[model samples]
Target: MEAAAPPRESRPGRDWDRITAIAAVLIGLAAVLVSVYTVLLQREQVRAEVWPRLDFYYAGVDGEFRVSNKGIGPAIIETVEVSIDGVPVRDWAEVTARLGLSDPGQLYSSLWGAVLSPGEHLAYLIPSGQEAFAQIRAETQRISMTVCYCSALRDCWLAAPEDDGQVEVDACPVLPPERRFQN
Candidate 1:
């Protein structure tokens, strides 16, 4: 060539390419961090909702036959069902009639409206001199109860004498307010 060309100089905006690339990497890192935070929060919420454990059992402590709650949560009792020889007794009236008792309340005082905490129970003590006492003493009756209860979180569960035992079910029911304290 007749003349030598001047050396080619880089554009003034050459630094802009590096700045754009850095900005993209920063945005991607931010997105990943947010995703991880969301996953951790969801895990915590699931653990809180399902951590309570409840169990129902029949045991003869001393001479008393008791239905007990051995759970960590507060059970809000909604309904109770008694079964004899696998036949379900629908109501307290039906059981009273079957037992030939004048009042069902005289039989089991704590069976209804029981708000059982851990280590709490309702006793089935056979009163002496009653004709029903003989049936109980003979152990001829296989009396068992299924309780439908809920936790403070409004999660419902069924405590039954079935082979599968207690399980989580629908939403907890809303109950009437408890009695007022006299003091």
Candidate 2:
């Protein structure tokens, strides 16, 4: 028989093969961990950036406090529920009835200017000074606003509270109107 080359070493050295296999497994595990971490981080960022919150100066006017939506995000004013000293105003029902429409766009168009998109924008008027109205003062009243809008991804975050008080379009801040709402 032709001299068979000494049987080639039957296999790679056990030490070297074991080390290589372990390294590969570690690398794969590390990649999976990194991917999961990245996804979680992205979700957190999205939650932080999506909504708009507005702070406004409420003053007594016409024997009532006039509260306006100073921050924007296609503010759903109809859905707004105002409270004075933790008491919910019952006049909102009358206001809604007078509005004659349930939608924000229609409500805005009926009032002034034109329909607006999600961002820092003006809102409907609330008259203060009436017993039902919150006491008008320089002290800031905590206002919680909620609304919904579409993203570039075409996904709707409907009626969701914007956590950071920021209204954004493609991740850009929508500036509040320079002229505050009066009356």
Instruction: Highest TM-score: give the candidate number.
Output: 1
Supply candidate 1's per-residue lDDT for 56. Answer: 40
- Give stretches of model 1 more than 4 Å off: 1-63, 83-93, 96-106, 124-134, 137-144, 162-164, 172-183
RMSD of 1: 8.6
Error of 2 at 58 (Å): 2.4
Give TM per candidate: 0.52, 0.40
lDDT of each residue in 19-65, candidate 2, tens digit only: 99999999999999999999999976775454333333333443332
Give candidates' CA RMSD values in order: 8.6, 11.1
- What's the lDDT for residue 31 in model 1? 100
- Backbone-clash count (model 1): 0
- Candidate 2's TM-score reads 0.40
Write down the lDDT that model 1 would get: 0.57
Cα lDDT tens digits, model 1, 1-183, are: 578888898876558878999999999999999999999999767646543444543343333335566666666776665755666565544554555554332334454566777666766443333444444534435655666777666677776544346677785434333211110
